[model samples]
Target: MCRLTFFVVVLIPIIFGFCPPGNYEYQTNCYFFQNNPTGFSTAELNCVSIGGHLASIHDGFTNSLLTQQSLSFFNASTDFWIGLDNLQTMGNNWYWTDGGTFDFFDWSNGMPENLQTQNCVAISMIDGRWSNENCFLSKPYVCAINSAATTPPPSAYPCSGGFLYYEPTNSCYGVYTHQEDQTWSNSESYCESLKGHLTSVHNYAEFRLIAAFASYGKYAPWCGLFSNDGGRTWQWSDKSSADYLPWQPGYPSGSGPCVALAHSGLINADCNQEQPMICKIQL
Candidate 1:
C-alpha cells in the first residue's frame, strides 16, 4: 500500500490600519471609531451618512481591538455606542442596528437588566465589556465600514448628451477613464466628436471633484485648459474665459502646452503622454 500525506498552511493576513484615512483595520473590517458624542439614533445616522453603521463586534478579538483603540484615543474606559440594541423588540434578543449577525455578546456583569427604558447597547472602552443603556444617552461611537468598500461614482443621470448633467451651467459633463489612455490632443478630439471640449473647472467644487477622480483612479485627466507663450496666458479649448485656475501649488514647473487634472490640482503634463480625460458639452 502507498501512503500519501498532504500538509496545508493557512495565512491570516497582517494588515493593520489598512483602511482609508482616519480609520483602522481589523481582520476584514475598517473601523472609524471617534470621540464624536451623540445619542444612539444620531450616532447611527452619522455613521450611515458616511456609508457605514455603528460598529458591530462578532468575535472576542474584534471586541478587544475596539476596546484597545478607544482607550488609546480617549484615554479612558468610558462607554462608546455600539450597534447592538433592542429598541424594536424590548425584552427580546438584541440585534445589530447595521443588520450584522448577532452571533456574539460581551455583556458586562449584570447587563441587559431588561429595563423598559433601556433599549440601547454600549461597549466599555475600559475592557470591551458591553452594557445596556437608555437610547437617549449621548456617547462616543465607532463606525464600521466594509474594508472592500469603494468610492463609487455618481449614479448616471439621464441627459440628452448621454452623460452626467451639470444643472448649474445647463451643460453635460462626462469622465472617461475606462478607455485606453491617449494623448491630450486625442482626448480633446474625441470630445469634439461629442460636440464638447475638455471640461473646464469654473469653481472650487469642480476642481475638488476632478481631483478626487484623479486620486481614486490613479490617473490624471486631460482638460480643455492649456497654456501657451511660456505659461503667461492660459485658455480653455472651448474659448471660455479662464476664470479659475486651481493649479498645483508651486507648479506649472514649466510652460506646458497642455494641462491635466492631478490629485493635488492642475499640473502641466506632457501633451503626448497617454492619459484619461474629462469632457463637457453645453446642451
Candidate 2:
C-alpha cells in the first residue's frame, strides 16, 4: 500500500480602508466616477453624502489621469460633471467647488461660451477637453475625497478650542473670536502669539478645509497673503513665494497690502481693515 500527503494554501487580499469600493487612489486623494446620469446639483449632493465633494481638477497630470479613468470606466460619449462653476460670480470666471484656482483648463474650441446660462463645467469623453454646460443637464460625475491623510485619530493630537488638526498637511487650524475686530496685522500678531501664523492655502484640499470654517461670518477672513516692498512683491506670511494665486479677475492691481479670502475669491484689502482671521500651525 502507498500513502499520499496533501498541502493547502490560503491567500489574503490587501484592503485600503481609506477608499471606498470601486474608488481609485491617486496621490493623497480617492476618486469615484459614477456612471448613472444625474443633474450637476444632485451629483454634488450625492458626492457630499458619501463624504466627498465633486472632483476638482488641478493639473495636467490629474486631468490626464481622470480622463483615462473615465475612458476606461465609463462608456464612450459620456460627459462627466466636475466641481467647476461660474455661478458664484459673473463673467466666465470659474472656480472649483473646493475654492481652488482654475489653473488648468482644456477647453474645446469656442467653448465655455462666456454665457451665464452655462455655468457648470464638464469634461468631454470624446476629446477629454472641458466645456460649460447647463447645470440642470443630466450627466455622470466624479467625486474626490482627501483620503486617510485628512482623517486621523483625534486623540493623537492636542488641538485646543476651535483649533482642529488637519491630517493631510499635519497642520492645526483655528478661528478665534475676539472682543473686538482686529486688523490684518493685529490678527497676524495674535496668531503668532499662539505659536502659529495666518493660514496659508497651498492647494484645493487645504483651501476647502479653511473655507468651510470661514464661511460662517459675513466678513472675509485675513489669510497669509500680502504684498511687501510697497506692493511690488507679494508673498505669504511665512515668506513663501506666491505659487498659486487665485485672485478674482482684474484684481491685485498692486494696490492693497493685504489679502482676504472670501467664498467668491481672494480680494486685496487695506491692511488696517478689521476682520476675522484663520490661523495654522504645523505639527
Per lDDT, the best of the predicted structures is: 2
lDDT of candidate 2 over 1-283, digit per residue (tens): 2221111111111234577667788987889888888777667655644556799988888988898889867884468999987755645578787566788898989987956578789998877899999877889889887776344344545456535665577777776545466789988887888888988887755665565555545688888999877667678996655777667556776547899876545788899988888888877
The lDDT, on a scale of 0 to 1, for candidate 2 is 0.72
CA lDDT, candidate 1, residue 126? 67
- Residue-by-residue lDDT tens digits, candidate 1, 1-283: 2221111111112233358666688777788876878777667655654556689878998888888888766654388998877654454768786677899999889988966778789988767788999877878889887787654444322244335454456566666764467788988998898898988888754553344345334577888988777778889999988998877766777746799986556888788987778878876
Q: Give the TM-score of candidate 1.
A: 0.48
Poorest stretch of ten by lDDT in candidate 2: 4-13
TM-score of each: 0.48, 0.53
Q: Which 10 successive residues of model 1 have the least lDDT summed?
A: 3-12
User: How much does each candidate deviate from the true structure in C-alpha RMSD?
Assistant: 19.2, 14.9
Q: What is candidate 1's CA lDDT for residue 223?
A: 88
In Å, residue 27's CA in model 2 sits off its true spot by: 19
lDDT of 2 at 153: 47
All models: lDDT?
A: 0.71, 0.72
